[model samples]
Target: MAVKSLTPYPFAPKDTVDKFPAPLLYIGWEDHKLFCSPVCVPMPPTTTFGDLVRGTLPGIYSAHPDFARIDWAQTEWFLSGQPFTPDMDKTLAEHGIGHKSAIRFRTPGLTGLNGSCF
Candidate 1:
């Protein structure tokens, strides 16, 4: 076996990335929402996994007085005049698609098939 000499891609952003924890805290109020993505955010090698764990907590955890009583990750609250609920599980169940993985069968190879499965 032989090793080849190679260099890191030059065009890639050198700005260090930050890794975030899973089961992350997300916020949704009216038409606005914010959350971190495990699929999108990148972290530097220097950042310990523990730091990732702490970073996912609510941004207001450091300041607000009443936020401690609520699990911001699972609970929703409005900062403005919009109506909101703290129970994300129940709210999503009522508003979101329950069965995300429902199969839609299709056959592309069959002749005269319009992408439908019989």
Candidate 2:
């Protein structure tokens, strides 16, 4: 199992480029057969893309080929594992992905992608 945390570095002020906030930490768990225990520090905000990538997701998640289509262009929500049959409903419900379905995706080849895999 892998423990994960998604925490935001303080969102910078719109006018100031260097104003970063301390990240709010969101934690999760990924295993050989399942992913569970999505917890966070300072309470994760509802579905923001940046939050998704930095704190709520595992870095090495890109290695898996099951979530390639899931885009974070509009947001920063990153993922860590591939969901199974029983997990489908819960996963969709939690992420508010109703019409969409999880499919095969590729993990990015960035060095240190899962470097933060907790």
For residues 11-71, could you state the per-residue lDDT of candidate 1 as single tens digits? 5433322224322222221211121211223333333433433452334232423324333
Give the poorly placed runs of model 1, Cα more than 4 Å off: 1-39, 56-118
RMSD over all Cα atoms, model 2 = 14.4
Overall lDDT per candidate, in order of appearance: 0.28, 0.35
Q: Give the per-residue lDDT digits (tens) of candidate 2, residues 1-118.
A: 2235587555534522133242233343322123333443332224453444444454534444433434433222234344422222233336543221222222233212243332
Residue 22 in candidate 2 has what lDDT? 29
- The reply for model 2, stretches above 4 Å from the true place, is 1-23, 27-33, 39-60, 72-118
**Which candidate tops TM-score?**
2
